[model samples]
Target chain A: MKGLLIKDFRLMKSQINFFIILTAVTVVLAVFSDNPSFVPGYLPFVMSVFALSTISYDEFNNSSAFLFTLPVSRTGYALEKYCLSLILGAGSWLFALAVTTVSGMIKGTAVFSETAAAALIILPFLFISVAVMLPVQLKFGGEKGRIILMIIFGAVFLIFVTALKTGEAIGNDIQAISNPLSGVNLKALFAGAFIAGAASLLISMKISCSVMNKKEF
Target chain B: MIKTENLQKRYGNFNLNCSFEVKKGCITGLVGQNGAGKTTVFKALLGLIYPDGGKAEIFGKNITDFTPEDKEKIGAALSDSGFSEYLTVKDIIPILKALYKSFDEKFFIRQGEKLGLPLNKKIKEFSTGMKAKLKILVAVSHKASLLILDEPTAGLDVVARDELLEILREYMEEDENRAILISSHISGDLESLCDDIYMIHNGKIVLHEDTDVILSDYAIIKVTEEQFKSLDKQYILRVKKEPFGYVCLTDQKAFYAENYPEAVIENGSADKVITMIIRGQEA
Candidate 1:
């Protein structure tokens, strides 16, 4: 597992310029934009995408053939990708959060508790994003994997929009559904989301392992 | 320390069923033309792909049960696959260090430099000879008890091939129990390095013989159609029709030399043995 992680980090180092540019853009957005989502939500999702890129690199040049022959099991290879996704996602989130907090304080618009809440909320989003992306990429790799993920995202957006339209036609209260009761336990809600995200991640890892184990090369 | 019993894999019309072994302290060669299932056999042994049926054991454990620790004892260099080209030699050092518990970093670097492989250059920038040498170097430096090399000398010049062969020679010299199972189309490389040879064709092993016996005892006897009809045929293994009557392949060179003084018999090389077995009809 350590070796696979090292190889991925080494592969990522080849894209160092891209890493620098993305961080620069995120920092600029965090300092200039008023949106709290700019820090934790945007950066981590992008970092999770970086984790998926490592999979493409492994597939390139048929490198997976040599990689599998090393002292690494297929299940371990799958597990390492998930661990890497979490590491990259969580690391970038913490960095973005710190930058956002400092910039907000300097701009005299700082609310520590609110900023903390937004950053904390994005953790679940990061986990869920990883849970969805890892298995998709592992199941269908390289160009095929990317195309499939795009279709998945498109289908999901269409389904969500259709559900909203159908609800309006049925005369359901959109505002009530969109904004839950003010009396609802806010802490409990985020906690429940976090738990759900964690559960999904475990299930996704299992599926990814099976996909890798079943892979020919 | 590697054995397979009727290993099988199927790809549509092509079917691979082969049995072979590599004993400790020996260099075993697998020779076959393209699409003859040599790569499939290597991939099966390395666990890069699963076999449809049969049993394979390495170091006395079933290949299906092999763990990461067991894999560490093996070093493999495939013909068409390797580390990603995006990585430099320097980038892979740490990765290799982490991958193999017995990896010798100092030895690897020293050998790389000796072979003129640049530390900063990505593998994509490497010459064919450089890439080939690096693969053998990596396989040998990890102290693996078994090395599975598929076409390690495939694209190299003669000199580069020799250098890579010397590396394998040194690898075998360093450990008494280490074994290497290598596949290459270049018969000279195997002729000089392998203790035994297995020639595969049409998804089966057609011939397996000790290198010494093949080189020293195997022979090709050219006989006229009249001589072939009247001559003793007990020793002929395969026969090919030729413009000059027929060519008979036999391992009993001396027997033919003594029995037919008028016939033309040439000493066997790896190339002749493989060609006759593949192209000639079984006698």
Candidate 2:
């Protein structure tokens, strides 16, 4: 496992450095800007792109044969990609947190507790992106993989926007199905996120492993 | 040791139905013309492509049954493929060392110097001959029991080819248990190195014989039309007739020599046998 990690790290050292620079810039911008909502929103999306690039590297370089030759199992390879993404996602959230804290401290504003929110919101998105990308990477390789990713994400984005507009049109007329403790609770949301993320990651890893295992070189 | 049982691979128009074995401690050469299933065989053995039918086993383990542990004992290189171009010889060594359980770093570095592979330079920057040399170096450096090289000396000059073959010979001497399977279109490399030869065409093994037997048993006879007419059809495996006379490909060299002492008979090398087989297929 450590060997696999080292291999992945070596493969992505330059990309990781690029991301760190981007993260630093984002951190600086979020700290200086007056918007707290925008800080959390963009971080997860950027982190997802970073995760996607790893697949791109594998495809572009024809690294599959090389990676498969290594002592690492296919299952280990799939799991390692997911693990790396989650680690990076966590780092992104933490960086965002630091930015928010610094921004709030500088402006003399009361800070909201964001620990639960970070875990709930960021982790699931990262895992889902990973889940969607792994199978595609296995099937189409990295280059075409990213193009497929963009198309799928684009269609989802269009549907999401339409749903938002429809929700606005039917505003307040639709009686919310309210129940005791049915409101958005950050704690419950975090638990749900963890469960969903874990499930998707596990399923994705399984699928990726099978695909990789069957792949010849 | 490597073995294949009716191994079949189909890629739309191209199909490879090959079966042969490289016995332990002997170099088996796969000799074929360009696009004659050399690379396909290597790919199938490495489990780089799923065979449509049949089986491939390396060191007694089927590719399907192989875990990561099984790969450590095998070292392979395809004809026109390699590590990423972004890597230099220096970068590639560490990566392969980490992957293969028995990677000999010192051996690799020494071969790198011997083969004239520039360590600091990226692979993309190297010449084609240099790249070929690098791949061969990697395959020989590993503590692998089986080394599968596909056109390992393709683009090399005479000097480089000799150097590379010499290095391979040294590597082979280290362990009596080790074996190698080299595929090359050029016959000289195989003639000098291989113990047994497998001649392939259109995805099938046309001939599998010992190197010495192939050299001694086959003969190419150039004779007049009358002499060719007089020759027994049973002795002639293939005949390419020109306007001048006939060029006969025969398996029974001694019988033909003794039977027709007056006929113009020339002893054929392994290269001529392969050529005759190819011409026979063409005809």
Candidate 3:
């Protein structure tokens, strides 16, 4: 598993410059706009997508076949991908948080509250994105997998737009929706989201393992 | 050290059923043309693909049941598969070190340098010969008990091929328990290196024989039509008609030489043997 991780890290190194430039640009935009939430909100998604790039690299030149020849199991390989995703996602999230907090401190702005809120919302989405995309990538590989992902996300976007339009047509009674959640415990809501995210990841890992096991080459 | 019994796999029109063994302390060669099912056999043994029937075993354990520890004993260099092109030789060393308990980092690096593999260059940047050499170096560096090399000498020049074979020979000399199951289109390499050789045709093992027996005993006799008609046919395994005469493949070289003193006899080379076996008519 360590070997697999090391190989992925090296493969990902080529994109390091791009990531650094993107991070700097995001941080600069956040500082200038006085919207520190933007950094934490977007960084996790970028990192999660980069994590998937490693999979593409593995599939390139049929390297995955050779990879299995090493002392690694199909289950272990699936688990390692999940672990690497989480590590990269969490690392990017924390880096964004630190940058936002420090820049806010220097500028004398109250950024922690906004950053924390954004983290809570985006972190779960990051986990879910990785959880969902992994099995698709493992099953279809890079080219076809990307096409499937695009179609799925396109459908999701259409559905979200439709829901928003319906809410507007219904006269946008925001208070009525908030009323039912007014007494809900924030801690419990966050815990539930975390549990759901963890469950999604575990299920994804199982599916990836099965896909890998059945995969030829 | 490795064995396959009635191993089978089928795709639409092609069916692969091959069985062969590589004993401890010996180098076994699989010789075949493209699409002859040599890769299928290798993949089955490595558990890269599930066999539809029969079993493949390494060190007496079924391939499907191999744990990480069990797999650690194997080092393979597959022709159509390899490390990501983005990785450099330096980047791969640590990964190999962590994966194989007995991986020798120093030796790997030294061998890489010796083979002219640039340490910092990505694998994609290397030429085909360099890539081939690198793969062999990686496979041999870990001191594996079994080495499965497919077309390891494909792109190498004669000098490089000889050097690589020497390295393999030295590796085997280090441990009598070690074994190698290799395949190459270069019959000369197999003829010199393998203790035993298996020839596959279409999707079946057509021939398997000891290298010594093949080189020492096998012969091809060129005889006139009259001579061929009068010659005893019991010793002939395969026969091919040519414009000049009849070409006969026989293992009883001495019998033909003594009985038909006027017949032209040539020692069987691997290439000649394969051609005759694959294309000749059964005697």
Candidate 4:
């Protein structure tokens, strides 16, 4: 498992420069913009997707076949991917939090409170995104996997646009439908999201392991 | 060290049903043409692909029941499978060290340098020969009891191939308990390296013989049409028509030498033996 992790980190070495540049640009934008939510929101999404890139690298030359010949099991391989995803996602989130907090302090802006609250909301979303994407990438591999991801995101975007247009057409009636949710307890919502994310991750891991075991390579 | 019992896999038109063994202290060779199921056999033994209706075992344990400790005894270099091309030799050293308990980092680097493989360059940047050499080097650098090499000399030049074979010889010499199973299309390499060889044609084992028996006892009898008509057919294993005469493959070289003094005879090498077996009419 350590060897597998080292291999993945080495694979990610080529993307280090790109990650650094992107993080810098996002931090700068967040610092200059009034809405600090951009850094927290974008960091989770980007970092979670970074895990899929490692899978792409592994599939590039059919390296997975060779990997199985090593002292690694299919179950272990699936678990390692999940662990690596958690490491990258949490690391990115913490880095974004630190940068936002420090920059807000230096600029004498009261953005830390808002950033922390936004992080709580973004954390579960990151978990769900990675939990769903990992298995898809493992199942379809590089080219087809990316194509599937694009289609999924495109459908989501279409749905979001249609919902916004429908709400605009409905005007005050849309607020009335959302009014009931305003009274929902914040702690309960967070707890529910956390539980759902955890469940999804576990189920995703199980599915990925089964998929790996069935793969012929 | 390795055994397969009626191992079977079907891929539409191609079906593999092979059974063979590689005992400790010797090298076994698998020789075949393209799409002849050599790689499939290797994958089955390594547990990279599950066999549909057979059993493969290494060191007396079924492949599916093998633990990481069991895998640590194997060093494999499979064709069409490798590390990510983006990884450098330097990057691979640490990973290998972490994976194999008996990995010799110093020896691996030394061997890589001796083979002219660049340490810092990505695998994709290397030439085909260099890549082949690197894969074999990694397989041999660890303290493994069994080495499974699929076409390890495919891209190597003659001198490099000789060098790699010499290294394999030394590896075997170092431990009596060690065994090697290598596959190649180049019959001469296997002829020189293997103690026993198995010939596969269209996913079936057509012939298996000791190297010594193949080189010394196997013979191709060249005879004219008239001569072939009178020649005894009992000794003929396979026969093919040639432009000038008939080429008959026979295992009874002594019988022909004693009885048919006028008949021309040539010692059978692996290539000739495989050709006669796969392409010739069975007796």
**Which residue ranges in model 3 land beyond 4 Å of their true spot?**
A111-114, A171-175
Question: Model 4: residues >4 Å from true position, as ranges?
Answer: A161-174
Candidate 2 lDDT, A106-147, residue by residue in tens = 777635565335434766776777788767766677777778
Model 4 earns a TM-score of 0.96
lDDT of 3 by residue, A38-68 (tens): 7887887888787788999999999999988
Per-candidate DockQ values are 0.87, 0.40, 0.91, 0.84
Ranking by DockQ: 3, 1, 4, 2
lDDT of 2 by residue, B1-283 (tens): 8999899988889888888999999999999899999988887777667789998888888876777788778777767677666667776776776677788898888778867888888787998788877877777777888888888989788887887788778878999899999999997777878899999988999989898877788898888989877878687877886787888888789998998998878876777888888785222
Looking at model 1, residue A163 earns an lDDT score of 91
Residue-level lDDT of model 4, residues A73-141, one tens digit each, is 888888889888988888888888877877778787856777688777888888888888888888999
Candidate 2 recovers a fraction of native contacts equal to 0.37
Q: In model 3, what is the error at residue B66, expressed in angstroms?
A: 0.7
Tell me model 3's lDDT, rounded to 2 decimals. Answer: 0.88
**Candidate 2 pairs with clashing backbones:** A216-B48, A217-B48
The pairs that clash in candidate 1 are: none
Q: Which CAPRI tier for candidate 1?
A: high
Per-residue lDDT of model 1, residues B117-202, tens digit only: 99999999999999988888888888999999999999888999989999999999999999999998767779999999999988
Per-residue CA lDDT of candidate 1, range A75-168, in tens? Answer: 9999999999999999998888888888888887877777888889889878888898889998899788889889988999999999999988
